[model samples]
Target: MIQNIINQNAYTALDQEEYQRRYDSLVERFDTTKADLELTTEQIKDKITRHRNLEIFLGELKNQGNLITKFDPLLWNSLVDYATVFEKQKVEINFNSGITIAVK
Candidate 1:
């Protein structure tokens, strides 16, 4: 939409004061600025979702104050997204919040 406006006004924008002002405003900015904003917005939303999930995970963890000697199925199901077993005694654990840990 904005690009369309810029394109349609390109002809009359030349040799005009308002157009020159508009051009000057855009001169300091890159055409890809919109894409940059979209990327960062996605990142921020992902981070927010992860943080909320982490909060729930932490709340459940707070119940286990002492050292956890036994495995908790609830914690595992809540925190783990998936696990992949590899050759040579290696396993990769993927968390629900986009984090991975490898164990050997």
Candidate 2:
């Protein structure tokens, strides 16, 4: 959009004062849009990194065989961040990549 606006040379068709106002507004909008795009890109990269890390952790856990059969410190430390016990009926397991699973 910014490139198209610049290529059109639309601002020059207006009077000096109007052209200045329009140009400034367009530039401001372009800057704001650019910043928003950069922020979105950064967020996407962070999500991808977190997903990759989770995959690697899962792979490591898979190599250890059945987790429910025995209590292994290394596997627990790598896969589960923490556990929340709710009364006597429910438990919440928080995984390393911010996923929580509830067991009842």
Q: Who wins the lDDT comparison?
A: 1
What TM-scores do the predictions have?
A: 0.62, 0.58
Model 1's lDDT to the true fold?
0.82
Model 2 spans > 4 angstroms off: 1-14, 68-95, 99-104
Cα lDDT listed for each candidate:
0.82, 0.80
Q: What is the lDDT of candidate 2?
A: 0.80
Angstrom error of the Cα, residue 45, model 2: value is 0.4
Give the per-residue lDDT of model 2 (tens digit) for 26-70: 899989999999999999998997888778777877787765687
Candidate 1 residue 22 C-alpha distance from true site, Å: 9.7
**In model 2, what is the error at residue 19, expressed in angstroms?**
0.9
Candidate 1 lDDT for residue 86: 97
